[model samples]
Target: MYKLICIDLDGTLLDTRQRVSTKNREAIRKALDQGIEVAIVSGRPNCFTIRIMNQISGRMGHITFNGAYYRIANKTRQFPIPKEAVMKVAKLAQKYHVRTYFKNKNLSLCTKSDPGILDYDQFKSQTPLKDQMDMLYNVDVVDVLSNQDINILKIFAWDENLENVRKMREELKEIEGINLYLYDENFEMSSEDTSKGKAIQNVCADLGIQLDEVVCIGDNYNDLSMFEVAGLSVAMENAPRKIKEMVDKVTLTNDESGVAYAIENFVLKENE
Candidate 1:
């Protein structure tokens, strides 16, 4: 019997329209009623994840920043990344003339003037950016600096030049303790050994649960680490062929409520 379920948000839980279906909500509620603990693990910040949870009155812990921070209940715990390493990555982003977004222990900062085309208001209605800024000690939107003094959690750069991102990944490989991942057109940088899998392990340990008691579901390369550690891994129907091949099961497509379908057909029905 699975005691914990760790789900990825964007492409797994939320449909292609970016909303949770009623059927999925009922499925999750049924699971919770059966005493199963459900959690969301994603590359998104807690501020965004919380808003999605509000729609269903769903309560669960979250692993955010690709597992850099663990948000459970209302308390947030962070795994600090070395300042020296953050500075080095900042310098590289500067060298390549790419935009960067970063989060430290007390603040969220970005170099992007517009934050791309993301609809911050619609996307974060529950835990708005203003709320996050208020909780933060400081927030800054400025030019990329090579010598910023910050203990970074994660740094992301968006560029059309995949080769540049690839080159940056290779250049940072010598940094010794940092991890780099390229997702779609963005490059994500984190501490040397931090990953979604490590974060899940930490959470499981905190709750006295074994890794085999957890189910991980996702649709992207960033989710691979979690998939590796989970006892039952699921991939969204829309996931890349390579990612799908790695999982234990493939459910309905995200457009067809794949996540909820998996829960209802697998987790919930098993309990019944």
Candidate 2:
């Protein structure tokens, strides 16, 4: 009876190596033919999400930037973070000497830190960051920082210290209207209302379906909120113990076509 399906990309839908399995693709096509709405919700940007969608045969919308932007069909809608919140986060990041990345309506900005901080060639292959000044460029990049006019969505800090990352998350919790999460060793900050769960709700409203008429599958901490709202929640076999406990069922590992298994065994069978 599920009318909508929300899927997470990196750890739930895509295999460990980050490719959608043939079995999963076929299963998804089968679901679409049956009138179920499927959406790819992820922390990645639209540029990267589009590449993944191209591999599938059908068209689907995407909830990206951890829910800061929603892309459907050919149009995208952006939700702006309050200017005061952005300024507060920026000041905190600077005080901690943490390198930060900013995303506006049309651009992503970051500092040129130690080459060791990132796999330059790999990053360049995925995103177009050339010709952009590093955050550490000559003058204080802080001067260029204006939360007022920019539709700041989320800000991320890349650091290798797990302890510091934890501390940063705790500190961000003090921010009045923002939500913070720790991914690996990075810290992600977004508006209190912007999350995968909220994005899914928005999509369901558009389709005139109830929240309980949806299924969500994912394998990370950020996905917990979505699982809470889904009627049928699934976790990948490779998911962390905490994530596995939050869902009603655990499917095959992503490496073993888990997404396809769930779709074929549950969603499609229901239609038949």
Spell out the clash pairs found in candidate 1: 177-192, 178-192
Clashing pairs in 2: 111-135
lDDT assessment of candidate 2 = 0.73
In model 1, the worst 10-residue window by lDDT is 133-142
lDDT of 1 by residue, 1-272 (tens): 88888889988889878888888777777777788888789877666777777776556677878888886545556675677677676677666655566764335565435334433444444674533521221223333334454567777677656777767777777775667776667777777657899988887887788999888888988899999999889999999999999999898887888888888876767666
Across 1-272, the per-residue lDDT of candidate 2 in tens digits comes to 88877889997889878889999888888788787877788987666666676678446677888888886644566676777777777666666666667664344555325444422233334443521222232213354566235567877777555665566666777787777776667877777779988877777776678988898988878898889889889998999998898799888998999988888886777667
| Displacement of the residue 142 alpha carbon in candidate 1, Å | 11
TM-scores, each model vs. reference: 0.84, 0.84
* Model 2 spans > 4 angstroms off: 73-76, 114-141, 160-171
Q: lDDT at 197 for candidate 1?
A: 95
Q: What is the C-alpha lDDT of each candidate?
A: 0.73, 0.73
Error of 1 at 271 (Å): 2.8
